[model samples]
Target: MARGAIPPLPVWAGEALDLITDMPSAEDLVTAMATQAEGALIRAGRR
Candidate 1:
């Protein structure tokens, strides 16, 4: 941070900054979630 109030940063936060600043890919998200099906464990914890 410019203010010096905060210690610089951890390695993972720097890496996450790059990832969060970039645009997310919808198709990639869908592909990644393909294994999860509708009505499958949607609310298992509450049940």
Candidate 2:
């Protein structure tokens, strides 16, 4: 991969890449994932 270039990805992987690119920042992604995990854990009664 070159600087600032997105390497080709498989269809499923590309979809995830799209979502990542749409995020405003890496911190936002981490926070969102953490919140989701917490929600899932709560729902599963593991939290």
Candidate 3:
């Protein structure tokens, strides 16, 4: 391999990257889940 050439990724690493690309931002996901949890709790009279 030439100097500074990128090495091949293992199969799992490539799959993990693909999954990560499809995910929403962490902040957005957390906010969405937290909102859902709050709504559920409100429906159950807990919050």
Candidate 4:
């Protein structure tokens, strides 16, 4: 594969491999950020 190009997964194993390894999506990032913020807020409240 060319540099920065993602290789196509074999059709038969695509589903399985995708579950094992995949890049994070935008929603994943937002969710993670929100989760961290919530944790920080909770800790601040406890202080």
Candidate 5:
């Protein structure tokens, strides 16, 4: 988040917490979720 990277969500879905001090768009959150999975895969050498 500090580096502008999206962190992964918790196992259970809940209300969104705006940590950026600003509201995030639906698409932005979706992209963050996707990027999180991709980042994990990359760490496992899958990407």
Candidate 6:
């Protein structure tokens, strides 16, 4: 693949991707999940 290009997803993964009709793109979902995980960790550290 060219620089910065994402490699092709596997067949099962491609099918799973199609099921996500209303969700944000995978990259956006990953970022949002990372943010939430970080917030949870910070909160736990304060306990």
Candidate lDDT values, in order: 0.67, 0.87, 0.92, 0.81, 0.74, 0.82
TM-scores vs. true structure, each candidate:
0.29, 0.51, 0.54, 0.48, 0.45, 0.48
Candidate 6 root-mean-square deviation in Å: 10.3
Give the winner by TM-score.
Answer: 3
lDDT of 4 by residue, 1-43 (tens): 5797866768548877787678788889899999999999898
- At residue 9, give the lDDT of candidate 5: 71
Candidate 1 lDDT tens digits, 1-47: 46747665786698888897795688877866764643355645522
What does candidate 2's lDDT look like per residue over 1-47, in tens digits? 57977667586698999997887897887999999999999999999
Pairwise TM-score winner, candidates 2 and 4: 2
**What does candidate 3's lDDT look like per residue over 1-47, in tens digits?**
68977767786699899999999999999999999999999999999
Error of 1 at 5 (Å): 28
State the displacement of the C-alpha of residue 6, model 4, in Å, after optimal TM-score superposition. Answer: 20
Is candidate 3 or 5 superior in lDDT? 3
Better of 1 and 5 by lDDT: 5
Badly placed stretches (over 4 Å) of model 1 are 1-9, 24-47
Best by lDDT: 3
Q: What does candidate 6's lDDT look like per residue over 1-47, in tens digits?
A: 58977767796588787888767888998999999999998999952
Ranking by lDDT: 3, 2, 6, 4, 5, 1
Q: lDDT of model 3 at residue 11?
A: 60
